[model samples]
Target: MHLKLLYCTVLSLIYGLALGSPAISDSSALADLLESSDKFNDHSVVQAFVEELKAISHSSRNISKCDQCVARLAVGKSLALLRPDLVPPVFTQWCTETQYMSNSTCLSTFSRNTVKSSYTGTNFADMLTLMDPFGYDGQLYCCYKESACSKPKTPDVSLSHKWPAKQTKHKVAPVPSANDTFNVLHLSDFHIELDYTIGAEANCSASMCCTPHSKNTFANLTSHSHKDWNSYYDSHYEGNSLVKGSLIDVFKNDSIWSPATTFGHYECDAPEILINSSLDSIANFSSTNNIDFEFAIFTGDAVDHDELSLTSYEVTVNSEEAVFRDIKNKLGDVPVYSVLGNHDTFPYGELGQENHGFSNYFAWNAELMADLWEDYGWLGSDESQYARKHYTGFSVETSMGLKVISLNSNVWYKKNHYAYWNASQPDTFGQLDFLIDELVESESKDQRVWIIAHIPFSADALPLPAKLFAEVIERFSPYTIANIFFGHTHLDQFEILYSGPGGDAKTIENVVASSWISQAVTPWVENNPSWRYYSVDKKTFSIMNAYNYYTKLNETFTNNGSAPVWEFEYSSREGYNVTWPESAPLNATYWHKVASMVNESVEYNQVYENYAKRFSPYVPDCASTDDCALDYCYLTSFTVDQYDSCVENVKNNK
Candidate 1:
């Protein structure tokens, strides 16, 4: 959810990407002094660093994107290596002085240990050691990894394999008058922060707040400014300030902006009690309603979003283990199929593609996830082993003869730096091949397939892979694939994919497929904690309706740790007040109709926006702005190209 914010901050600060912004006067002066020949024993290296900084600043717009990137990478690497001991603290001081990032966030993300660890054992680290400004590795890292330039264009991959001949007209299954349906539980982005503190600063200045280490406010950040470097350095970095003391300690006496509630807060991830409450609610609701779910799909993101300084290998593993265990305990005997989210890993978003040479660096995650799945009886021994080798992706055929293909969609995630290395290829991890194979087999068996993954193939995914995925959907959607499900945006949303790759839908016949982007369980940002379940027609195995449920997060503040009242939010078919034949499945065509309604009717659009974030107070006025039109554009488009074109069309009309 904080993907763009984190990426931009890192690229702008750590990579020295200027982005046409004028350099901060104090930071530039400090850089000049730090790179002076008098301080460094290696004057040549210092001179090289100075020149690179000059090139980055003065010629930022004129230089080739790769050159600009290379210069920034070179300068930053040289500065770090020149005085490994002094660089992190100096950078921390500069970061706080300019208010580029919170002092806690900067120290945690760019500490001496973090910096040193980043430069050790990895291929990227080796590339940095080479110190070749003009090297291909440097250019690749800058151009693709940092995305300093437009990604290289590649030809559209013809449908991975030719699909079966279309039956003159597409055939959709009809819903019977008394549709025999079963429920499907979908929970995503639990994001349980183990160190969550009740009554802590929910309005803290960190990227993620409400944790034990989160600062109370930004008013005290000046205490670590560049002017106080000597004194601050002596007291702060000397003993346990970097490791032992909490960053929250400095602002302990400050009044909290918004005291974190018992259940959760808008600015932070879900606390343990909140996670338990959510699970308890789901269990109680299902039992009370007698809605026996066929199987639950936990679509990734078990770990918390404490990425600034709180994330580590131990935190990730422990958090995931605790969350998964809670799921198993609360929802007994209901097998849960889960996948790894971008935040589920140690470095947050560094999952490596198969055969990418650095794949082993990420093997531990797959292995760990596989072990848990097997122990929890979610997957068979063979299936878990297969997932272990397949980047924690597995396909399991349910007792009902439906093929459930769980994918590790992080291969297409924008935050995973490993994905950008050779991104021009259509399928970086052979996942497309695996998907096609599964779909082909399911089609032959006359079995409907449900594809579940973490990240949606929207703007969050890279263009090439998302395009390939759309093409796959266009090929096999109505015939074999029943639905595609994802969760990452933390909003209750869905997108309709049309017939062509660019998703040009001029007629209802162009509707090919749809993906359900489930709302997150974590109230990260302003979203209320929510979960959803769909009524799937047993005969067609397609979703007939989706029911959303959520609790008022603010209500928990007055309840004194009492369980929040979980209320029925809305249902896809009846809630929106949209018209459709009751006998028809809620497919792409139905969603396309919803988009059309949203585009033309202001009243309906406001209702849609209210339901999106479960009535979060911060929900924007889509009807008053261009967002309703843009939402229409997003819903009607699948591939990135189509999304871009739709956005352009909306802007042009505006």
Candidate 2:
């Protein structure tokens, strides 16, 4: 019995060895074939055999048909993996049983009708889920109901080329019949400094002016000048340097510094060199063009700091005198009138007292047509104490019928002292009283009034003052204030505010002049640093103008020469026309051409929204204002995609 059992065990062992060795050897061969087939045609029958063998090798117990089935499965997987581009479409057409499988069995399960369905209707989403594990590009194939696939329709991507038509008929107001013609040069924010300082020399060419030196040179010169001047005059004479070293130092040594002597302190002093260059340029332009200006108006910021302190007042007055002298020398007898800026008031000092010493300085510097108490009694019994002796008005005849009303906005700084002092003053209510008085007077005489001030009556970016100013203008509607000219925000924009007796208030046109000191370190300079030139008709009191300004430093220097200058042509008519405020018609064609030219050349970004909100009603008429406000509002409400679309539209239109 033992011998027989031994014989059976030996036979069983031999049988197992023979079978197991072959299976193991086959599995090895299958792995090698599958890996090798990955590089060749995956549709090979041999590749399928290899994959099936791999599956069978891993089974716990061998079945008679396991090897065959494994080989077939491997072949299918190899074909699917290597020829996905071909296999995907075929599988989608034929597969049905296990929707996720790409094998022939699954393919055979689908009905021919189902396989012939449109690609869009095919279970592409499910196929993607199954293929994701294998990292397939699911977009490789799409099934269609027809035997042949059709091309997808192409999308239209061309931009619309039609130009926009003018939305409303913009009627040019009538030209008032006037007899006298006056030539006026409108300038503002003359922050003049003596000698080229505060990057002034940098603005000039080395061949024409001084070479660009290190900041240390500026520092050394400033220190030497301060010590030298202090010893010679008063220690306060430290402000005598033509170019101050650093702003921090200047602020620290404020007492010893004045606006005139210190160069690097503020933007005001830049006008010294700028004005000289500008005057030279203007002279050339005037000679070339044969235009003579009658008078010049400096809107404001005549000095950097308005203070009751003696040194501050002295520096400011001296600076103004120097500017006036320069103007007189350059233009030859053109009287220059200046209105005070917010900075022209005592710095955080007394608001009402006329004898605040700062007021006296202004009075002393002004030509003084009449005493404030004697001429204007609007200030009440304490007029002498609080009224600005320098706050005066004069009428200039642009031609026969056109007149300009230049008023001081600083007067209202008393009630809203915070606006001017805190740098947050809205341009409105502060000057309503003065504006009303001027409007009434101009309307009564039937004179076209060109209201001039330092700060704009309305700015889309800075709207508090604009809204306030708009309300005042609305109160005197249909009176036809020819135009309101201002210069505070530095950028050039036009807003037209037209309010008829019974119609909706229309703030359609408000024109802002650019600053002269274009490249100063100050925020205004960094943003808007161009100047504006105006051309007015003497006979009709009609004004047509353009801003030929740019921000290219080299270009500005090249055109301006060693010193840059600006020029304008002026003429006047014989009589004054007070009855027709809107009568003075502007040249719409010319205006549009100039506007188009400017818009094409310059790029303006939105910087003020909350300010614009104050004057929302008047914004629609303003291209920049409305667009900027809309951009801000859209960004707040929509997704980035929607916001981008709105922005693109504005840019294309502009």
Highest lDDT model number: 1
Candidate 2 weakest lDDT stretch, 10 residues: 229-238
Q: What C-alpha lDDT values do all the predictions have?
A: 0.70, 0.35
Candidate 2 wrongly placed segments (more than 4 Å): 1-172, 176-183, 195-271, 304-311, 348-390, 393-401, 412-431, 459-468, 475-479, 498-524, 527-531, 547-561, 564-654
281, model 2: CA deviation in Å? 1.6
Q: What local lDDT does model 1 show for residue 108?
A: 51
Instruction: Write candidate 1's Cα lDDT for 1-654 as tens digits.
Output: 134223323433534444453442234443545546366565444344444355454654666756666655555544544344444444455445545457775565345242123333332332343334444345445544556655444445666544565453335533434678888899999998888875567768677788777766755443322111110101111111121222223233345546665567889998877777778888888879888888999888988877546678888889989999989888889989998888887677666666745556777888989999999999999889889999889899888878889898778876565564545556768888888888878776767889999888765777778888888887776867888898888888888887743667645778788899989889998988999998988876889999999998877655434466789999999987778988788888888788778878888788878888899877888756765667777777776677877878877876
Tens digits of per-residue lDDT, candidate 2, 76-193, equal 3333443323333434333332233444324322211111122221122222222321111111111011112221221222111211221232123444445344345666655553
Clash tally, candidates in order? 0, 66
> Which candidate number would show the highest TM-score if scored against the true structure?
1
The predictions' CA RMSDs to the true structure, in order, are 10.5, 29.1
Q: Give the residue spans of candidate 1 off by over 4 A.
A: 1-67, 70-155, 162-178, 217-254, 625-629
